[model samples]
Target: MRVLEMLLVTSCVLVLMVSLFRNTINRKIGTIAGIACGSLLAAQLLFEGYRWQMIPVYIVAALLVALLLFRRSKITKPLRFMILALSIVLLGVSVALSVLLPVFHLPKPSGGFSVGTETFHFIDADREETFTEQKGDKRELVVQVWYPAAASGRSGEKNTVFPKDRGLFHTYMQAYSGYLGLPAPALDYWKYSRANSSIHTDLHPAINPYPMVLLSHGMGVGRILHTSQAEHLASHGYIVFAIDHTYSTVVTAFPDKRVTGFLTEQSQDRLFEDSRAILHVWNEDITFVVDQLEKLHSGAVASKFKGMLDMDNIGMMGHSFGGAAAFEAVYSNPRIKAGVNMDGTLFITENRDAMKKPFMFMKSEEFTNINEKQAKYRKTPATDAELKELRLTREQFDNILANRELELKLMDRLSQQGQGRTIYIEGTGHYNFTDLQLYSPLIGLTGMTRSINGTRGAEIVNRYLLEFFNQHLRGTESKLLAGPTEDYPEVKYPNSVYQGE
Candidate 1:
């Protein structure tokens, strides 16, 4: 829950408790103000999600009501009744707003860069082969193919949506608030929901395969997590395939009515090892995909896509654990030309001298900040005015230490090489890299509590990524990436020297 939402709930609880105990006018005022604040907060929670920072406002309001009830006879029974009436109205309105915001227009954040885009799902049986440990399993993989298509023609046939899972995805998505103990999601969860592909596919053909790029999402995240990024690249002529690493994602439901949830990544014994296994599975997946692309380009798939694939040029990319998988794929497969690591901590072991390849790193500012490290104290507010502060046990602290070590070690090798480029987006957290940040504002005080402006941050990061990819993958000479551009002073080119050539 966000700080603000928590505070509001606390305030409401206090008002109710104090009102029941006291017969005074001040206590009544407190009850009214508390109810109003609670209504607003509940609206926020029902609409946006929970945040921690909103508590102060409710606290101040509660205090004011308490003072008025105790000291000001001006706030009579009638005046208190009027305030109570207003509070009730506000509560109703808040509920309505919370419910409408998700389905209706939640204003689009402005100022993001444009890039090529396309998304298509391709089912493959070989996904099972990548899983040696789980061999002979019915390995159905959902491959979201993103590629460069002709600027003026239909790209490929649109894949059919699985009507059954549409509702399920929507339900599970909104249910996140419930799990966090926040108010129920107020909006229609299916508003942004659609088939895996985007609109331009009607005119773009799967033919000109262009350069191939494979994407793997982080743990517990589905393939759609990087939807915007994948589409951007596809529109610009890169065949991008986002692989849903079976059992790595939280849940994957295919058209055939099969659903599988990822084994939790929290288990220590299997965390790193399982992630590595996923990478190898991805490597074989990519290689097989490349083979299929070759056949399709050679007119072998003999369906609607005949002569539209460019199978020769290929690359790989991933986010977080997926980013680490990108490195692992490139390390294992020579066919992968370039790679992009979106602030993922490394899992693969390789020599600093031997592992030389073109790579780019997009890291978050939270990881770089010293004071933002995991806190020792945890707080929770149920209802209002009642705040519970929990002490972090030794185990929690140790877990944090382990995570820090893992992150540091992952970046150490790239830091040593001093060849690749890395950009730490200022004021961004780990979740900021993916589309998860976009969901913050929908959950109320969370947007403010998390300090995520959403608009400027994503724009800056998108520009940086586009500029970097345009320079390296497409061989476009971009001064924006060669060094810091004048417009974006927030981006720093650490560990990379500028060249005059």
Candidate 2:
């Protein structure tokens, strides 16, 4: 909970307790308590903002203040007791809600530049929208760009973590809750979230023509989930583009107020089988976005990106299924120099030997070691007694062994394509690759993320991103990627071969 809000809850509890004993307490004590409650309520609203979770508490505080007006009237003891019990329950509920789904902060940017962001709506006429109901519709994309910016803009204002539009933001909140597979009401406090970037801040002339990156979210996820990473890249002198792949996103709110939710027929477990066609569309989306980048400056109204972007030095990256798409971009798109995939398995398994780009996969330990799960069973077969203790049927154990063999075979086929570097973050899970890990501490508790501290995970991820992009995009190089260092012990290159240009 916010500072003023916490204080108000404490004052409300004290006032309610005093009111419950008003017959024994001085009338002046009740008056003072009511005044304090009213004053604190005003301060909370002025500084801390209102929330639906606090509505019950707000009602209780208002009732306490109103009692001061009727101080001469005698109150029944039972009624006072009821008020006390109800107030305590309401306050307790508010505290729990706020703690569970906090208005989280993005870790401060470690680079020299402050971040600035802008959103653009683009439509691809060449490709028809395949997932839509219309007879003929072009694919529409919502792209948000983050760039290095001056310390202050005219308003000196920063952007909200989600959309500023109330209707859209509320819809995003609903979609995010669904994304996490949580109940809709769980993340309602997300409406008050903040980001580290300012909107449309003036860019220094020297910062122009920075290296670029196109960011894609995980399958069925929104682009804002990658905001923290994008901001960090921008601060480090790379212009980053994050796309809300429309129907594929958890939710997308267009400028016309048309809201779209996940329309893709892909699930996490089925992605390897179901995502081939979807991958092509996302690849096209990335290509079309690059094409649109060139056209933005051609219009009569000069785009803010005019001459401020280095289109030739472009890099690509994505999390989960987005990761595979990044590999596709670097492999197929001549304009893309390098890419990284985080914790996503490949959907496009064919013709990948042609992949010679500077690329790597930053995976969670669980995902990285998946092919080796059945290794133990082969080395020292378990006895019937052990199998019974584990409660696995003979066939189930056989199936596990078979699955591991198939995964290993698939990985061997991938290895034939070429050497690929992989960085495994210890005590991490798939969501750790995106800002969703930092949504709340409860995420770690639920095993959505693992034992890694969210902020530490972000720091490690950003440092590598800065290093990789610097070596491939900018003319600089860092030893972090050349070989493993004592620094960032959480990052490992197990079975990894550092690719040199």
Best by TM-score: 2
- Estimate, for each residue in 260-279, the C-alpha lDDT of model 2 and write its tens digit: 89988964344345677888
- lDDT against true structure, model 1: 0.55
**Cα-based lDDT at residue 447, candidate 2:** 74
Give the residue spans of candidate 2 off by over 4 A: 13-24, 55-93, 152-157, 267-273, 297-301, 374-419, 482-487, 496-501
lDDT of candidate 2? 0.79
Can you give the lDDT of residue 368 in candidate 1?
Answer: 58
Q: Tens digit of lDDT per residue, candidate 1, span 305-351? A: 35655444566777787888777776677776667777676655545
Off by over 4 Å in 1: 1-135, 147-166, 170-187, 190-200, 203-209, 264-266, 303-309, 370-419, 442-452, 496-501
